[model samples]
Target: MGSVLKLYIQVAFAVKIVSCSITMVDNTTSKSPIDLSTAFLLRVDQSGQGDYKRIQEAIDAVPSNNSELFFIWIKPGIYREKVVVPVDKPFITLSGTEASDTVITWNDSGDIFESPTLTILATDFIARYLTIQNTHGNTGKAVALRVSGDKAAFYGCRITSYQDTLLDDAGRHYYSNCYIEGAVDFIFGNAASLYERCHLHSMAEESGAMMAQKRESPLENTAFIFLGGKITGVGSTFLGRAWGAYSRVVFALTYMSGVVKPEGWNDWGDSSKQRSVYYGEYKCSGPGANRSKRVTWSRSLTKDEAAPFLTKGMIGGRGWLRPSPTHFKKYQTS
Candidate 1:
């Protein structure tokens, strides 16, 4: 009878393991099936303890247009280099244990498109628990991170710079539990993105704007939606300013400190844009969330109006947001 019980327990354990593997490898969250067993893992450690000493070296090893996933585990250290993931390399995950320990920093100011510290041009990329920053202090157009790829997601990351910090350029992106800091037009972009439970800190001394959305036309499906986050900063600032004719941005269920300006939205010195842009806020609390002095062009969204921005569905997250890999195999040099 004792042997019979032991055999039953062993069978149960085997079933549990199998079920967990199925969930990971079967791409349950994605519409398309991803055989995570094929995923490759690379490591970067400055202490001479990994596949490559530098992060870009490991990224260069990935084959162009490869279908397999590559997981680059970055060790705790500060990496000072300019990194770019070309469009050909997709399904790559840059993982670090903690954002405070593993950092990638560069100091470059000017040409926002050409001089970003890190540029992600690949699709289906993920960054987890890493700090990406540009220390071009109060300089002109210094972009810490520029993401132009489609279906990219950043989790537990810290992205910082001065002006034009994060260029959410062109794509459908998701930022969850991240800290973003900057002064003027820091979170500007034309991407259809969802910032969930993130912290946005403004470093402006006098006055600046948190976002400068650049949606050119009403027909374009691009907007910035912030959900369940907190906005705290040093000085007064506007929630957003219209950077395009039909710029759009929204904040819902967020806590805004007194740092936010009474007049929520700016028309970018273009009175013509007041009629085309779509800025809205819903169920937001705190002193800054008060819309008594908000621009007439902006909206205080109702429950029904805010429903669309409330879920991951706005960015089709369920179809592509694979938060974790099934497994990892150590890097092998060929």
Candidate 2:
């Protein structure tokens, strides 16, 4: 009887130890919620003890499948090179040392017949507080930021180019408090994107101000919705033009400058789009917000009609995602 009791006690103790061990392992291996604060900081001045000096190098060094929330903190300086964040690398954060101090300036446009300044093919990526520009001014299709991955976010970053400043190639993306400067078809692509509290600047030209969207699929209700943002441009720019026949875009509760053309939409030389594309606006204010005789195809959306497109769930439903503030803050306001 004594031996049996001792055995039972030992068994209970072993089980407890095993349970604790499993709990510790789970805690250590579980995905850490991404906050911009804990991500790595990349300083361009060669000051930190990080493994790499250049931002691209640092990004490359991260193990491809690293579940850890890796950050590349860029110090104050201009990084002049085309950067590609490929699909295999997810949960990577890129932020500047300071929003105003760090700059990623390059001179290649996708229209250069080959190169694009930045091509992001990774999901769960965040970029903040940096300037991404194609110094090759006025060049056609010069994409400063081309995002082709899902669950990507950009905050307080400046994306500048002449023709195609931002390419929302594919994905569900969030852009908040960022500045995008471009000319014809500047913000074009096939993504379901949301621009909240952003500034869209149109460079001087008669060729319309902003291009709201360019979605390709009828099955894909990909929409670009601008909320509480400002749109200003040079000469006269249409709010958007259909780069794809199935393009869908909306401007809601936005402040517009006179630069927005009354037509609100351009053909982009694709007449077939007139039948399929959907462009609309709601409660827009400013000299350019004139709705008189706006294109028959584009109209103002009712408040109820605009609700679904306004949230992050607009693209992928409720399980979509929430932006990582720490990661996003590192990149916002450039």
Candidate 3:
């Protein structure tokens, strides 16, 4: 409920997930002979020095049904590709040079299903210190990152797009110290995802919605929990919109800039969605957090209800969210 508790909850969550000594450094993979006894490290560089030139090449080289950790070091450069870690691949890591330096990008619209710059559909996948962008401009619903795998974690990463920046389609996900920017429903889908100390930026022309959660059933284990983050950007934006009957999105202990619309949640054109969608915020600050104008259907979560959002347990990722140490210089969005 409080910022201090949120910090403690996330730290405790990471403690349960992290274990090991072997780490990887890359411009893409560590090429040295891996001591599986220690760690599997592969280096990647577009200049053809690392294990693979393209990120997908390194990914394709990985053996399937892997139980051990496989780390890829991505060199500092702009990689133009749509990368996917299939459903059978697990325990994979794509470590980058830096969030700003190492970039994997593509341009695709959302006409067909699964149109994204990066789609991770494997369990126990981890990506750190990189920027995943969809350069398709604001023409349509372009997605930058789509995570459909279970128990995936993203640390110190930047996901940028115009319409749909991140589609947390399914699974339990953790995003820590990350930057996510888009215009409408940028952070969407039905994943049980936790965003800790991240930045949500809105690049809107007029009316923009930050998230579009699509949880249709009451029994579905899905929600978007944004804890201890900041919302800042241009134009008018709502905190989220309901994409399904039981859509859910929560912002706890966050700072909302003036660009955020006071209504906070939109039901789109469907007035019925307002009755079923669960949208809430607790103890948020900034001019955009003006509760007087917020919709009556939305709520100010009680501390008990808000407490769960701060913990990794809310996303059912308690045992596998171990985020490795990061050297990312925190970007300021103030």
- The numbered model that scores best in TM-score is 1
Q: Per-residue lDDT of 1-334 in model 3, one digit per residue for the tens?
A: 9743443343223223333332224313333442333335556789986558999987887767765566677878999999999988887888875789889999899652467989998998999889999989988989999898999999899999999889989989999999999998899889999999999999996999999999999899799998998999999898998898999999999999999987878888899988888898899998988899899999899999788777888876767775443221111112
Better of 2 and 3 by TM-score: 3
**Pairs clashing within candidate 1:** none
The sequence of per-residue lDDT tens digits that candidate 1 reaches over residues 33-151 is 35654456677889887779999998998878867788787888999999999999999988877899889999999998987988999999999889999998995899999999999
User: Model 1 lDDT vs. the true structure?
Assistant: 0.86
For model 1, what is the error of residue 156's alpha carbon versus the real structure, in angstroms, after optimal superposition? 0.5
For residues 99-194, could you state the per-residue lDDT of candidate 2 as single tens digits? 566788787754532456778888888887788888777745677888989988887888888877888888888888999998777787788888
The C-alpha RMSD of each candidate to the native structure, in angstroms, is 6.8, 11.7, 9.7
**lDDT of every model, 2 decimals:** 0.86, 0.71, 0.81
Compared with the true structure, the alpha-carbon lDDT of candidate 3 equals 0.81
TM agreement with the true structure for every prediction: 0.90, 0.81, 0.86
Which model scores highest in lDDT? 1
| For model 3, the run of ten residues with the poorest summed lDDT | 325-334
